[model samples]
Target: MKIFNTPSNSSTFTGFILLGFPCPREGQILLFVLFTVVYLLTLTGNGSIICAVHWDQRLHIPMYILLANFSFLEIWYVTSTVPNMLANFLSDTKVISFSGCFLQFYFFFSLGSTECFSLAVMAFDRYLAICRPLHYPTIMTRRLCTNLVINCWVLGFSWFLIPVVIISQMSFCGPRIIDHFLCDPAPLLTLTCKKAPVIELIFSVLCPLPVFMLFLFIVGSYALVLRAVLTVPSAAGRRKAFSTCGSHLTVVSLFYGSVIVMYGSPPSKNEAGKQKIVTLFYSVVTPLLNPVIYSLRNKDMKKSLKKLWGT
Candidate 1:
C-alpha cells in the first residue's frame, strides 16, 4: 500500500475506500441478499410496533409510548448504516464520500446514544411503576414522558458533537481506507495523520460514561423492583411483575453486552474482525429481534399488534 498525503482540508480529500468484507463475487452477492432480507424484516418489525402503538388506545401509557419511540429509533438506527452497507456489497469500488461518511458517522453514533438514554429512561419508568406504583400515575405524566423523550434525543445528539467535530477537523494520512463496513470512530481515528493523545483521552472518557452510569442506574432500579416484587406474596403477582420486565431486560442485555464489548474499551488493533462481527450483531440483528421479543413475550403488545392488524 502506497502512502500519500491527505489534503489539509477534509473536503479536498478524494474520499474513503471502505474495505468492507473482501470476498468472492458470489460471497458479496450472498451477503447483499442476506442483509437486504434482514433490513426489510427490521423495518417491518419496528414499523409494526410503531403503527400498533399509534392505532391502539390501550397502549397510550408511558411504557408503550416509550416503546413506540424506541421502535422509531430502531428504524433510523438500522437505516443509518445498512443501506450503505448493502450498496457497498454490490459495487466494485466501495467508495464513500467524505461528507457522506461523516454524516453516517454522526447519525449512527447519535442514534446509538439516543438508544442508551432511552433504555435508561424506560428502566426508570419501570422502576416507578413497579416500586412506587401508588404514585406512578402522578409522577410519570404525559408531560413528563414527553419531556424525557425530548431529553433523550437532545442529549444523544449533543453528547458526541464536540468529539466528532474535533475528530473530523483532524488531518487524515495516506491509505484512505477504512477497515469496516461503517464509518466507525476507531477506524477513522486510525486513518488520522497524527494521533492526539488529548483527543483520545477525551473520547475514552466520554464514550463510556453515559453507558456505564445508566447501566448502573438500571441495575439499581431493577434491584428495588425485585425487592418490591418479592413482597407481593402471591405467586401470580410475582410472575406478572417479572413478565412485565422480562422483555426490557432481554433487550437491555443484548444491547449492553455487544456495546460493552465493542466500545467499553478501546478497540484493539488486532481485533478488527471480531469488532466488526460484534457490531453487526447489535446493529443488524438486535433491531430485528426487538419487536419479536416484545410482542411474543408481552400479552399487551401481542393483543395490540393483533388489533392493529385486524387479525
Candidate 2:
C-alpha cells in the first residue's frame, strides 16, 4: 500500500508506515501472543496495586496514596504504545495516519515524562519520611500531596508540548516509514524535510538532560535518606528505613538506568533495533515488575494484596 500519495510530493500527507519488527508471519503471531500476555500482566499488576491500595484502610497514608497514583500512571504509560504495537504485529499494512502517529508520539513521551516526575516525587517522599520523620506528616499533608501529583502530570505533559507541535508542523516529503514501532523524536526528526536545528537542540535538551537532572535530584534525596538511616541507633530502625526505600530505589534504578542509556546521547539511525529493545525494557517490562517490587518489598502492601485475593 502507498503510504504517501506521491513519493516526491512533500505536501501530500496520507500516512506513515510503521516498520515494526521485521519478522516472519509465524514470528508475528508469536510476538503478538507474547506481547498480549505481557500487556495483560502489566495491566493486572498495576491494576492490582491500585485496588490493593484503595481496599486496605491501613494503606490510606501518603506513601500508598502516591503509589496508587503512580500505578495508575503506569497503566496509561504502557497503554500509550503497546496496544498499537500489538495491532501492528498482526497487520499486513502497519500504516498509521499522521494524526495517529503524532498522537502516539505525544502521549508516549508525555507519559514517560510523567513517570520521571513521579519517580522524583516518590524519592522526595521517601526522603521526607526517613530524613525528617517528625515533620513528614506536616510537610506531606493531603492537600500538598494532591498538589504535587497534579504538578507532575501538568509539567510532564507540558514538557514536550512545544517541541512536538513544532516538529509535527514541519514538512515530510517522502519515504514515510518510521523504523521503530512507536513514533519517536529521532525518526521524526530524520523524516522531516526541512532541517530545524533549533528544534533538534531543544528536543535534545528536553529528552535527556532533564532526565539526568531528575536522576541527580533523586540521588541527592536518597543520599540524605542514607545519612539519616545511618544515624538511626537501632539495627531494626535502620532496616525499617532502608526497607521503606528499597523498593522505590530499585524501581528508580531500573527506570532511569535504561532511560538515560536510551536518551543519554542522541540516537543514531543505525541503532533502531537497540532503541526498540531499550524502549521495551523501560516501557513494557518496568510496569510489569512494579507491583511485584512494591508488594513483596512492602509488608503492608503484601498483606493488602493477600486480603484482596482472599476476598
Candidate 3:
C-alpha cells in the first residue's frame, strides 16, 4: 500500500510523483513506442469518423450527428491522459504539478462523465427511431438534439466539481506519489493526511450515480428496441434493426464492462494491476476500436469513410 519512499507533511509537498508502471529501460521504450502508435491511431480513427459525419449529407441525421459529437469527445478524452502518460514514460522524475494533476483529474473524469451521458442519449435516439418511428422525426428535432448534447456536457463537467474542489483542499500528509497513471480519486484519497469520511462517502455515492443511471437508461431503451425488432414481420427488417444497434451495443458492453469492473467495485490490493489494465482498455483501446466497429458493420459509415478518402 505504501508506494512512497519519503513520507513528508502535506504542507511541504509541492507536487506529486506519479509512479506509473515500473519497468526496465527497454520495457519503457517498448511501451512508449506501443502507446504512441495507439494514441496516433486513436486520433486518426475518431477523426475520420468525425469527418465522415460532417461531409456526408446522407449522414446528417440525428444518429450520425450524435456519433460525430461523441467522436470529438473521444479525441479530447484520450488526449487528457495519454499525452501525459507518454511524457511520464520518457521522464525520469515523472512529477506532476499539483495544478496539473487536478486539471487532468477534472478533465478526464468530466469527459468520461460526458461519454456516459452521450451513450444514454444515443440509446434513447435508437429507441425513438425503432420503437416510435413515426414520432422520431417530429420529436428528435435538431434543436432538441443540440440541447441534449449541451446538457450532457454541462452536467458532466458539473457532476464532479464539488468533490474535486473539496479533495483539492484536503491536506496530504505523506509521500505525494500517485500509484496510477492518472490522478484518480482512490489513489489521491489514499494520499490525504487525514481521512475525511464525509468526502469519501460523497465520492462513493456520487461517483457511480451518473454511470449507473445512464447505464440503466441505456438498458431500458435497448430493451424496447429489442422488443420492437422482434415484432418485425420480415427477417431482413429484424436483421437491419439489430445491425443498427449492434455497434452501439458492442461499444456499450466494452465501455461499461471495464468501467464497472474498475469503479463499481471496491478497491483491493490485488486488483491494482488489473485496474491499470482495465483502465487502459476502456480509455485507450475502446476509442481505438469504436471507429472500426462502427465503420465495418455500418454500410453507410463505410461509404462515407470511402467518400472522405476519395477512394
Candidate 4:
C-alpha cells in the first residue's frame, strides 16, 4: 500500500485523513483550547483518585482498591483518543497511519469494555457487601478483588481482537478519509473496498452484546442491593447504602446511556455530529465526573481528598 500523496492519483491507500469536525482556523483553535482544558482536568481528577486511594491507609479495602484500578483504566481510556484528537486540532494534514488508527480503535474500545466489566464487578462487590453482609469479607477478599480487576482488563482487551484483525485485513477503497474524530468501526467499514456483510454481522453481534449484558448484570446486582437495603432496620444504614450506590448508578447511567445511544445500532452514516457529541460525553466528560462523584458522595473519600490536598 502506498503510504503518502494524492488520493486521486494513487490506486492504493495506507493511511487515512481524519476530517475531524469541519471548522475554520479560529474554530479549531477554540476547540483545541476547550478540549485541552477538559483533557487536563480528566487526568487530574482521575489521577487524584488513584493517589488518594494509595496514600490513604483507610482506602486499602477492596472497594477503594477496585476504584483505584478503575481510575487507572479511565486514564488510559481517555488517553487512547483525547491526545490524538487534540493533536489533530493543531495539525494541518490530520493524517493517521493505518496501523495507528487500528491501535487507537483497539485500545479505546478495550478500555471501554474493561470499564463496563469493572462497573459490573463493583456492583457485585456492593451486592455482596449489602445483601450478604455476613459473608462479604470472606467472599470479597482483596485477593478476589485483584483477580476480578485482572479479569476485567484481560477480557476487555481480548473482546475486540478477532473483529479488529478481520476488519483490518479487508481492503480499503481509495479516498481514505474518515468523517469523524476517531477511528470508529462504522466509518472504517464505510471505507472498505466492497460490501462486508459477514464482517458487519460480526460487528452487529459483538459490538453491543457485552455492553448490554454487562449493563443488565449491573442492574440485576443493584436490584438485589436495593431489596437488601430496604430491609435494613436502621434509616442511617439505608441512607448510606443509597448514597454509595447512587454514585455508581450515576456513572453507569452517564457512560452506558451515551454508549447505548451512540453505538446502539452501529452508528448510521448520517449522525456524525450527534455521534461526536455523545462520544465526547462518554469518553471525555464521564471520566472527569467519576472522581467528583466518588469523592463528594462518600464521606471517607471526601476526608481522604481533603487530606490529600491538606485542606
Best by lDDT: 1
Q: After TM-score superposition, what is the CA distance of residue 159 in candidate 1 from its true location, in Å?
A: 0.4
lDDT of 2 by residue, 1-311 (tens): 32222235445567888998998999999999999999999999899989998888889888999999999999999999999999999999999988888889889999998999999999999999998879999999989989999999999999888777777777786687899989998888888777788888878777876688889999999999999899999999999999999999999999998987887657677699989889989999999999999998999999898888895
TM-score of 3: 0.95
Measured against the true structure, the TM-scores of the candidates, in listed sequence, are 0.94, 0.94, 0.95, 0.94
Would you give me the overall lDDT of model 2?
0.89
Off by over 4 Å in 1: 1-12, 264-269
Report the poorest 10 consecutive residues by lDDT, candidate 2. Answer: 1-10
Candidate 1 lDDT, 95-180, residue by residue in tens: 99877888898899899989999999999999999999999999999999999999999999998887777777877977789989
Residue 247 deviation, candidate 3, in Å?
Answer: 0.8
- Top candidate when judged by TM-score against the true structure: 3
Clashing pairs in 1: none
Report the lDDT tens digits of candidate 3 across residue range 1-311: 43232234334566889877889988888889999999999999999999999888999999999999999999999999999999999989899988888889899999999999999999999999999999989999999999999999999999988878888877676678887888888788888878888888889888989999999999999999999999999999999999999999999999999999987778777776877888889988999999999999999999999988899
Clashes of 1: 0
- Quote the lDDT for 198 in model 2: 88
lDDT of each: 0.90, 0.89, 0.89, 0.88
Model 3 lowest lDDT segment of ten: 1-10
Rate residue 152 of model 4 by lDDT: 98
Candidate 4 lDDT tens digits, 183-251: 999888988778788879889779889999999999999989989899989999899889878888888
Candidate 2 deviant stretches above 4 angstroms: 1-12, 265-270
How far residue 295's Cα lies from its native spot in candidate 1, in Å, is 0.2
